[model samples]
Target chain A: MDRATTETKLINGYQHEFPLVPRPFQRIGESLGMDEDEVLALLRDLQDRGALARIGAVVSPRTIGTSTLAAMTVPPDRLEDVAALVSAFPEVNHNYEREHDINLWFVVAAPSENDVATVLHNIERRTGLEVIGLPMLDSYHIDLGFRLPCG
Target chain B: MNRIAPSPAIDDLDRRIVKATQSGLPLVPRPYHALAETLGVTPEQIMDRMRRLLAKGIIRRIGAVPNHYRLGYTANGMSVWDVDDAAVAETGAAMGQLDFVSHCYHRPRQLPIWPYNLFAMVHGRSREEVEAKVKKIAALLGDREDGHDILYSTRILKKTGLRLVD
Candidate 1:
């Protein structure tokens, strides 16, 4: 396989089928007909280029901790200041500005429910915006990684 | 209210493995061995725990996280809908099964201001493609769907994966 083919395989194919073994890279290399050294180097390069976000497990929020999707409407003028303040919280991992009346949206993940409450409370007080929790009541599909089209 | 049943517990070694690899496993020939040395465990021990973790659903999947933007999925439309609360489960399940809907979740609706309780994240090469997908969702939802809106992300202020600590 060529360089582009290998990258596509690494992105689309391996996103859901990483070998769990003592030397997982060796397994990946064996399958790709590339040596361990070559596979490791290629992965390192991809990471450096920001083409790959992370090669890790996607833990379930309910099993690991509590999390809630919160949104707020910050004044257009204060959007920058309020976003920066909200992003400063460790719990607020994803803070995005979407097109809506309640523009600012983020997710708060914590080890416990109390911790989540504390973060939301602090964000409310600091930003002076009514933060609404949109916790997931039921999740049917949530595969975060998307498959890249490879020809 | 959804009552979450307690899941099977993971022991100390499994927690250690999860913590180590949550950020990412080192891109190396013997990544498990490298992690073993740091955690004062054998390579086999680390591998064993990882195997169990994957099987037990603690680790959803071990895989590559393809940067969607880099892969040409530049548009991410989070389509939200106000559905009949009584029949939301059936409608949400139907929407979730759609091919283009990457993620579908039934969330609590904020009254008056925000009446959307069903959220489906649709990704595509263009905003038009995402809008078309949302239309499909609305069509599938039929009369049960009260109102729907697509909130395409204008800016990514901050994006980070779930981690134990910053």
Candidate 2:
């Protein structure tokens, strides 16, 4: 794959304005002087290369109910076992570890405040480890999108 | 010619639709209708197209994005776990069952630089409360429990939709 082509087709493709039509991508292609297939191919290529994770809605959970960010500290050898236990819950939307002792981190979303508590409790019982439940008390901004410069 | 199903092409219009609805469906009474008017298409068309996008997997989900801080909770932590590959699916399912866990998934262990694989986010009102929960999770996984960490979000730089092209 041509790095220049990938970068041109994808990085440059990000800045294009969004169309406000039923077939918005079609219009977008027209503006870019490329067909819909060309635009999509570029996106797929990016995904294959791991540049783009997935294109999806970034909806706020607060509008629906309650949520939180919780983490834990597990023994180095038991990392795999603990992660498997933590990921078993359906409410967890995003989970990642960082360079720290308390590494197991995850996000839990529930329909209500009580549900969050119950989920935490369940994790505790199932995993036999204290599952920390850190509900978000404030949010500065919840948008994760970024505009990559076209090189 | 032997043919493989080519990925669905995302045209400019699709990107626009995603951008429009990415943030959310308008809070107005006739949000879909309003969007249709703006897009110069019928509301039915917009709805149908959205449905198609969902089916195509281009759009993972269409729902509300909550602001937890505004709702009276603030402490947020990213919990990472190193789970056995065979048990990851099972463990992830268990973690997903928790209502407090908003996000959970299995990521490859990057080793050295990044070792933790399975990850989840837990939110709470206070650090103590969050810590209390973590203690409980440690006991649940038993022998499989490995080193874990709590990388609290000191500052949220950006959290929004994934721009496909960029």
Candidate 1 docking DockQ: 0.64
Write down the worst ten-residue block by lDDT for model 2 chain B: B157-166
Q: Write the per-residue lDDT of candidate 2 for residues A1-151, one digit (tens) a residue.
A: 4655554544434432233344544555676676766656655565566455443354343433456666677676887777777666666665555446666767676656677778788887876776665553332222232333344
Q: The CA-based lDDT of model 2 is what?
A: 0.57
CA-lDDT, candidates in order: 0.83, 0.57
Model 1: residues >4 Å from true position, as ranges? Answer: A142-144, B1-8
Q: Candidate 2: misplaced stretches above 4 Å? A: A1-151, B1-12, B55-58, B164-166
Clashing pairs in 1: none
In order, how many clashes per candidate? 0, 134
The prediction achieving the highest TM-score against the true structure is 1
Residue lDDT tens for model 2, B1-166:
1111223466656656765776455433345677778788788877777777655655545532334553334677667777777777667667655656656655566445557766667777777777766666666667675677766754332244322212
lDDT of 2 at B18: 65
lDDT per residue as tens, model 1, B1-166 = 2333334677777777788888888887778889999999999898778777777666677889767776678898999999998998888878877878878889988888889999999999999899888888877878998899999888888887776552
